[model samples]
Target: MKKIYLFLLALCWAGVSFGGDFVVIVSKDCPLASVSTTDLKRLYTGKLENIDGTSVSGTNLSMDNPAAVSFLSEIVGMATTDYKSFWLAQQIRGGSTAPAVKKSVSDMISYVKDNANAVGYVPKDAALDGVKAVEVK
Candidate 1:
């Protein structure tokens, strides 16, 4: 039992430490070709209203998702707990809510593909048939 627990813990740690790269995606119809991490952080945090003349909305995967954790910590500069606390305070203060949460990568892909103003992130291996991947600098 102890060995099993240790193995599982190592597996989870490996996944977090060496997760696949992720891409920020937007609808193909969106005019912007790419976005910097600064701009992405702004968009996701509701600081930016538009990108390159197109109105933009952001979506996030479930808080517990590994990709979500990576994006929040590496790109958004916040831990999962900190991100949640920030949003919670924003809500209590009657500010804008957090980005809509997608249940899975497929849901995120579908939402970004269908909504011209939407932006989202997914594991780089995920299918990206209709949406455009934005280069992160």
Candidate 2:
């Protein structure tokens, strides 16, 4: 019974760690309140620019960050490796530039807080004092 309880506990902890409950955050001054997942995917993939009339500058977390992986795979519809490859091809072809990447969650928050047009994502549990989260539908 004790072994079973411990195993369940470990499973729960793993779920908490890998679960993708990320929120799309932007500067508090941003006019929009929420955005759809489709729109978000478009914005991140460079297929669309600006959300509703507000120019959007997208920021990304480092490639190795789990949140980044989730955002890329779950939200952006691309694996991290494939995403990097796509961006590299775009860059080589003189297409639109990739979003700026921050090394940590704190750095991502700081960048979004400072840039009024910026949009980024962080884990739902992250402290978002200066930024506002846009509901992902």
Indicate which candidate wins on TM-score. Answer: 2
Question: Which digits, one per residue and each the tens of the lDDT, describe model 1 over residues 28-90?
Answer: 988878777787888877788787778888899998888898888888889999999989998
Candidate 1 lDDT for residue 112: 90
What TM-score, over all chains together, does every model reach?
A: 0.82, 0.83
What are the clashing pairs of model 2? none
Clashing pairs in 1: none
Candidate 2 lDDT tens digits, 25-114: 999999978787778888887877888898997789998888888888887889999999999999999999898999999999998999
RMSD of each: 8.8, 6.4
lDDT of each: 0.83, 0.85
Stretches > 4 Å off in candidate 2 = 1-19
